[model samples]
Target: MNVLINEQYDIYHVAHSGVPLLRDVKQLNPDVIIIDIESPNRDMLENLNKISQFAPKPIVVFSEQQCANTTINQMVRSGVSAYVVGEVNQKRVKSIIDIAIARFDLFQTLKQELAETKQKLSSQKSIDKAKRWLMETKQLSEIDAYHFIRKVAMDNSQKMDDVAKNILSVASIF
Candidate 1:
């Protein structure tokens, strides 16, 4: 492992009986992480999930045999970028890392875009609810309702989404 890693890039190895903390890895700030584990235990997998959420980095896991499909899926979902089940060698190291990094980046981008889309949908829902409230209670046209929300947002220096949410909350009691 050292021979393969040492050829192209510097390496840092932290030995631990249990799972290493995410902070330990964060401090190193490696471009990619390579873990050679005979079998990834439940605690290790859980720690990987926490690490993925806290400080995302491309991770390559080299194991002797593939675990259950559910476990493999969980690892991927938890940010294990590449899982290699075979012998590790100098020839394969760089390519595996490259693939892992690429996949990690793609996954992160997708996750971010999905979050943004969901936020936009939530905002639109809020705006629609507020507009419906105004049309029912104040007898305003849809256009008028939208204009009122926009005006309030502008006056208060807030986002239209925020203003819409405020309208819904404030009008809820009445």
Candidate 2:
């Protein structure tokens, strides 16, 4: 694996024995990671998960042991972009690395989109709550309340959700 990788990419760091994996990965910040193991263990999976959460990178694993579907799922959840259960073929190494990088890129895009969608939903909820409060306190219609909030937000160069939260906080005081 080292020889094959060295031909294509520069080896940033190699772990021979008793090396801290996560800390090294965070510091070096490699473009991708490849691991050869006899079998995937719980500790390895946990470390991979932590790496995924902190400093995400495309990971490819080559294992001699045939694992169950559950194990494969766990590996994917732990951020293994590519998992091969057989003898490592030199011919396939390049393709495998390419596919792993592509998968990782797609996963990151989807994750970001999901986070933005959740934020939008939360902001809408806050805006709705503030509009309801305005209707009750100021005797304004829903559309008028929305316009008022929008005007305030535009005037102050702030987000509507932020204005809504401020209104809610003031309402809570009374």
Candidate 3:
């Protein structure tokens, strides 16, 4: 680790943890974390997973032993972005950090897109339910029901989904 910490990049903080590693990482807010371990045990992998949920950052793990398929999958799921099964050297450290950061960024982008898609789907479902409620209760056509909901949303300066939810709530009371 010392060899890699030179003019290019210096270590922000050093910590050895059996537990509570996530707390330290959250406080440090380092750009990347590099873990040098012979082979990660189940406890270590679980810790990494927990850390990923709360304090997400680029993680690079250098393992001395060749990792099994399951080990690699678990580490990836647990938020280790770059898992290299080999020795590390001063020259290689910078490249590894760059790769880890790139991979982490890609993962974040994909996650954000998935979340957006799900939100859109949920909103659409709610809007459809509200449209159906209006069609049945108000004796309006589907298109008119949709227009009424849109007008209410625009007049109230609320999102369509919020307006839809309001309509559903009021309809359910009767």
Candidate 1 global CA lDDT score: 0.60
State the lDDT of candidate 2 residue by residue for 113-160, as single tens digits. 999999999999999999999999999999999999999999999999
Lowest-sum lDDT 10-residue window in model 2: 55-64
Candidate 3: list runs displaced more than 4 Å. 1-87
Instruction: Give per-residue CA lDDT, model 3, range 1-174, as digits (tens).
Output: 332444665665666575565566556554445553322432463355454654332222333243345544544553444422224452464465544444554666888999999999999999999999999989999999999999999999999999999988998899
Backbone clashes counted, model 1? 0
Off by over 4 Å in 1: 1-87
Better of 1 and 2 by lDDT: 2
TM-score of each: 0.54, 0.53, 0.53
Please provide, for model 1 over 1-174, each residue's C-alpha lDDT reduced to its tens digit, 9 standing for 90 to 100: 232333455545653434464456445544344443333533453355464643332222333232335544544554543422223453455565544444555666888999999999999999999999999999999999999999999999999999999999999878
Per-candidate Cα lDDT values, in order, are: 0.60, 0.62, 0.61
The residue pairs that clash in candidate 1, if any, are none
By TM-score, rank the candidates, best first: 1, 2, 3
TM-score for predicted model 3 compared with the true structure: 0.53
Write down the worst ten-residue block by lDDT for model 1: 57-66
Clash tally, candidates in order? 0, 0, 0
lDDT of 3 at 73: 56
